[model samples]
Target: MPIDMSVWQGRSDPEDGNKGLRWHQKVQPADNANESGIMLLGFACDEGVSRNKGRTGAYDAPVAIRRALANLAWHHEAPVYDGGNISCDDSNLELAQYRLAEDVSRALRQRHKVIVFGGGHEVAWGSFQGIGNYLVQKQHVAGNANEAQQPPRVGIINFDAHFDLRNPPGGKQSEKGSSGTPFHQAARFCELHNWPFKYVCLGLARTSNTQALYEKADRLGVLYKDDHELVHHKMEQTLTELQRFIDQCDYLYLTIDLDVFPASVAPGVSAPAARGVPFDIVEMLLEPILKARTPKGEPKILVADLAEYNPRFDIDNQTARLAARLAWTIARAIR
Candidate 1:
């Protein structure tokens, strides 16, 4: 779980003036508590994918993503820090997720905008837990000054081809969680705490998910748009709905599963989309969420992550580059 210092290395040019600045030049270790800015964390795990009977190479995605991001042009004014990787070793996927949650909570408490690079969609579980823990801690610190204050309403916006709400092959007690069960787990967590599960899914493929999953989504009151509905003509409506979702929540957690893009655009995921939404459309949808702020001027996005990039299946590092580009966009757009 230590930071791989070598992954951040890239070409440096001192003579090019401001044009020479790149992520490698700006990114520092997230070891200093006083410096608050963007914190990048990697979830080095593929056990979830393996358990779900998908490809197994996603565990190496963190390093791949960092290598792709290292040379990208830097435009953000805030400091960037690498918090290293939370690795799932020895097939102990649960333990790794717990560790990731701990790190994420710590980073948020320190007031850093977090971007988690994933091993699989399973990363969502850890990220969700971390945000939840941070909110609880913040509420506790606020004390009973306002007993009437309601808990923060967290809305999750997931861009994926699949619903990813499947239970393990067996029941929960008989099997551990997998890449396809994170959102379901999140819903259960919210239910246990008596909190609302406000989830919005985009780019769903009717062929990728089963009827049972659709039923589950409806029961959970999940709002979603199919791949067919995300076209250029309908984008305005989509953005309007997205804004409504944002308006209802005090915090937002955005997670992008690379498989949501066409196979040609993101061929390295565990499950590539047969017919996916275009990257430009996805970016268009993301812009408003990235820029959204509370009436108090506080940023609504508390934490975000990109999941399920399997480098082993990548073509000419296409998926890696796209993930890095999305990360870059997030860093620049977040206030």
Candidate 2:
């Protein structure tokens, strides 16, 4: 895949030198052989969102979000890589998803930290597939190590407005999965592989999710906190729950759906939150977790992603800017 240089833009001032260089000037196309820095992979498909009966503009989000991120000043020494995108058409969702998994797997194999920008929440399925495959491969290579020497567990933390636990139509992949069903797919994948799925969902909206969804989440043993509880009150308690969950896992994958923020700050999503958690609060919750090391002295966070930003409905690019800032936060926070 070729890098789309067209998405990157910023002024280069010789007088100011390195101080004036933005992310666009600093980021390069990925060199898989180079075992260093962060790589950005874009999933440019909204067929999943459309199939889930949501808006159609999310397919164009990767470029729009990149345009927002490109002009931001580069403050970290970690080099950034634009690994290009995995695009999908209406007739080929499965192929695109498979290619994304392959690309993600390739990156992980080379020990590069990955930041995936999504076409929709469905991006999680591909992202999880890649990470799982890589870890499973590692286990096989270990070749019957003692239980204490086994590979660490993988945990997922998602910040979103809805549970996204809807059952796939006809109850299988042949029915075609959607943005609203990625986590469901992920949970099933975990079960099939016997991988410990320590999944935690934050910033859920009680009004947005149906009773059936809640029941499904309960049956799956998913841990979740609603928006009201986290944003309006019990903030400390929420953090405690999050900490407890994080403490039990060795490797973590963080996914943020922009809709988890208030509509005023992020209106360009398929489902905007009426009263969502503030960005600052989210930063508060993430900073320590991202910076922390596991009990085994390994970095807790392995890969992260930002999902569900639709450029078509944005106002003054507010949503895109938020996405960029969050990406910047992740880059700086990762150890």
Candidate 3:
């Protein structure tokens, strides 16, 4: 569980520095007592992609994203920690996924804002596990009620090309989950923990998902918007809807699958979008949510992850850079 520090090299010219010091120079361990911190945990696994029948190479995303972020200007004062990575082999994906959960939970307990970069969309399930556990622990500490006479509601807002609601492979016998099934797995996880699953998925491409998947989403009560509906005129309405969902949740988990962006912008993904949502549009929706606070004035976005960044298929590192920009936006936005 060590971050490959080799990726931390970039331009450094202090005096004549428009191409100056980068994130790698600014980032340090999240061991500060005076300031809130951000922890970067890499999930380097792509077995879920194989199971979901998508292209591989998502396993290499974490480091690529880190490298991309290394050259960005450090706009935030909070300390950033490298939590290394949870690597998965073909035989031990389950173990790796579980370990990721443990690391995320520990980070939450330490009060570090957790930002996980991933190997696939499967990263969502593990990240959600940690966030869910943290909230449950917080509730227990507060005597099981948050002044609302109920446990805090947790919501998931996913920006993706697909619903990722595929059922466990072959129904019952092969219960192994895949990238396409994380949200479905997450919904079940919620049910088992007595937590309500308030999932809102945006940027879905109708052509990318099947009828059965749509049916599955409906059955699971997933609130989603198709890619076609995210036009300029509908942007405000979208945020209004997003705000409505955010109001109900005590905590929130935001996930971005890079494939949700147009293929020209993010071609290096397991599945690229033909007509994806633009980056600016996504920012409009996410910025307000990231800036939001809970009833107690705490940051509502407890944990977040960026997934589906495949360096193998990228053109001139476009996708990795885009992913890094998103991470930078989150890091700078968080308190």
Candidate 4:
């Protein structure tokens, strides 16, 4: 049997914020044919160290987020392919998540966009492989022409509270992945693959990061845009800096870990920043990004992954709903 995706009712098409849209479960490929455009690969991660490892509910996240998003089918025309979730269990922990990563990577090679829901931010590594593979293949195809090397650059923009560049911190294994280490692993993995990348990390709070991580990021030439710096400087200047990062990436993947948001806006995050990037600052900074047009004249940003939404710590699922609106902003970028 061929892979058939799962598609919940997402407004049947994007419409005016479909607040009243009711969600019903539906499997994709209603037949076994390949349909294209932005594929919403709904993956969940449960291995990233949970506050409660004994309980595997974080794995339930993608299902919840998907349910919420389906109700707000604001992106009516956005092509969505729900490649379902990998079961997170003991024996297949690595393989389950690895397959999720592998599937996402393969989809990316085929030029399908992805939005990964989460058990944790650790899934960013898989998402990175998928997007990075696309850029690297194109880079090799162009083959050393400096101008060719300049094909629209591909970048990864991470919105988080910590720098997440810890180098196994003296080779300590996470036993399983840690919520604190996805970016760290992502940066290193790309380096090992010989793929030079453009990176912009926004809302990284100093409180949660180690000084060494800052040094490492500098050594790697990664652009670290923290909340404090953006707040102190003129907002336009900050946005300009973001554009420079965008300039390097032909294919861009935006990863927004909810931890980057303040306790006020998105309190459901496991690690909220002490000083949030005021809601307005985040809006202004991302405006240009959301407005970026693609080679086909649509939005440039394609895949995205949002992690660390803990409803137990949340207020009325406000975070998910708010994220839905933000997803709308991103989908608008696509069209």
Candidate 5:
């Protein structure tokens, strides 16, 4: 589970110096916890996918994403570090999530912006927990001794084809959660802690989600825009709503499930979208969120992740390259 140093290799052109630099030449292992910058963590687990009866090859996504990103042009000035992968051993998905949470919390504590590469959409649970833990610690350190005090609101914005709100199989409490249950679990977590569950989902396919899930989302007061509503003609209205959502939150957690894109663009996902949103539109929506800042001048996005990338079905590494491009975009937006 250590940082796979081999994947971080690519072309080199010393003659051009900085102009020719790429991520492979710039990214270093985050060996020092005190180093504050951007950190990339990998969730090398597909057990959740298996449980959800989806494709299983997403477990290898981190390495594939890194390889794809390695040769991309480095366009940012911030120090980038590879925090390594957290592998799921056997069927213990819960344990793997706990480990991921620990690493994510540690990176955040060190003031490193985290961008996790996922094994599945299930990575959301661990990533959410880590962000929640960090917020709790931060609040405690700030002398907010009263637990009853309103905690900072953290908004979750997900770009995905499915709602991922299914409960554990058979409604059994002892059953392990799957890739389709992360948001449901997150909602429960928010309720347990008495925090507002501010979630907005974009690019959801109407045919992909069931009526029960829609009802669940309504009950949870989730804000969403379907795929049909994100067209060029409706973009202005969509972005206006998105901006209003952003304005209400103190922080943001952005998660992109590659399956939200058309199968032609992201065929290597657990569930390929038949009529997905175009990459240009996704990028357009992402631009405002990435550039958004709080009233105090700090970036509103605390953490972000890319999920559901399965390389086994990829054609010409198309999906990896796209994921890499998104990662590059996120990296460049970091301030």
Candidate 6:
């Protein structure tokens, strides 16, 4: 029998075709006379998790997501530089992630808006570190030493399957990046750095969180709203409040766990949410931020990354399409 090679087709030219559509330019973040709004980044999550055990082929998420996003061509006016996927080889996960985050920082420096396709939620650690570093450096250059601690204004918005607030299920303080703990690690970093944090977690009604997680959230004062609460309340009103929260921060970054969408809508995520945010609700909740329309001389923004897409579990790439579409919506509306 002869070996097949088409399975590796996308690997060689990851940026070529997205959702069967061609993209004109998919390169490093750039600044041009046309003055585009945001930079688009994509990546696979952590390095070593087995595909079957975790989320099927989530490692290939970046490519498929880029393809999906590339297909839309709706936000054509937005200046977009496809920074490509972060190299997620397990041998040096941190370094790979840091390099990718550095690319994100570079985009921030150029004042490009960002929406990253991803590997797993764990990449948030490095991404945050990169953004925080940029904020700190810029403040020093501006001679705001006294306000450096607060220079990098940031907020948290998430739609995830779990709170990810568990504190060392085994009592160890820190562990290498894992799907189950990125939020906790990220919160710790944000709190230590004194960044403006209005952490609002949405679509997390299903989880195996223990009492310890609740106690931890209590201690930290994390603001989380469950699916039920989101359903009964006016979504637009709640999103208005959420926008106000992000407006208070100097830098804004959002993380989307594919599982926040119902299994029917986004089956490609790491954990498919049995009951997830509807397309309309998700759109409404994100409208304020998407319609931000911030121009130059305004605050430089830290990019948003969409993580944890496992196409092996997807239904005809529907979830990938939705996630990519959502990324574009946010990009167009970003300030």
Query: TM-score, each model?
Result: 0.96, 0.94, 0.93, 0.80, 0.96, 0.81
What C-alpha lDDT, on a 0 to 100 scale, does residue 128 get in candidate 4? 71
Q: Point out where model 5 deviates above 4 Å.
A: 32-34, 143-148, 170-175
Q: Candidate 4 on 54-141: residue-level lDDT in tens?
A: 2334566676676667666343454555666665666444565577677676766666666777766666766776666656666677
Question: What's the TM for model 4?
Answer: 0.80
Model 1: residues with Cα > 4 Å off, grouped in runs = 170-175
Runs in model 4 lying further than 4 Å from the true structure: 1-33, 51-57, 73-75, 91-93, 136-153, 169-177, 293-299
lDDT at 259, model 5: 96
Alpha-carbon RMSD, each predicted model: 1.5, 1.9, 2.4, 4.5, 1.5, 5.9
lDDT of 3: 0.86
- In candidate 2, what are the lDDT values of residues 1-335, reduced to their tens digit? 56877889876776888887788888888854355778899999888888888887888899998999998988887778889989887547777878888888888787777899988898888898888887877777775664455545778889999888888986855437888887887778787777766788888999989999999888877889887777636778878878888888878889999999999989999888899988877887786678768777756887898889999899999999999999998887773
Worst 10 residues of 3 by lDDT: 27-36
Model 4 residue 43 lDDT?
54
**What TM-score should be assigned to candidate 3?**
0.93
Angstrom error of the Cα, residue 237, model 6: value is 5.6
Tens-digit lDDT track of model 1 for 245-291: 88999899999999999999999999989999999999899988999
| lDDT (0 to 1) per candidate | 0.90, 0.83, 0.86, 0.64, 0.90, 0.64
Tens-digit lDDT track of model 3 for 95-175: 777888888999999888999999999899899888877777877878654455575688899999999988887782344
Compute the lDDT for candidate 1.
0.90
**Which segments of candidate 3 are over 4 A away from where they belong?**
16-20, 29-35, 144-149, 170-175
The better-scoring model by TM-score among 4 and 6 is 6
**Backbone clashes, each candidate:** 0, 0, 0, 13, 0, 15
Better of 2 and 4 by lDDT: 2
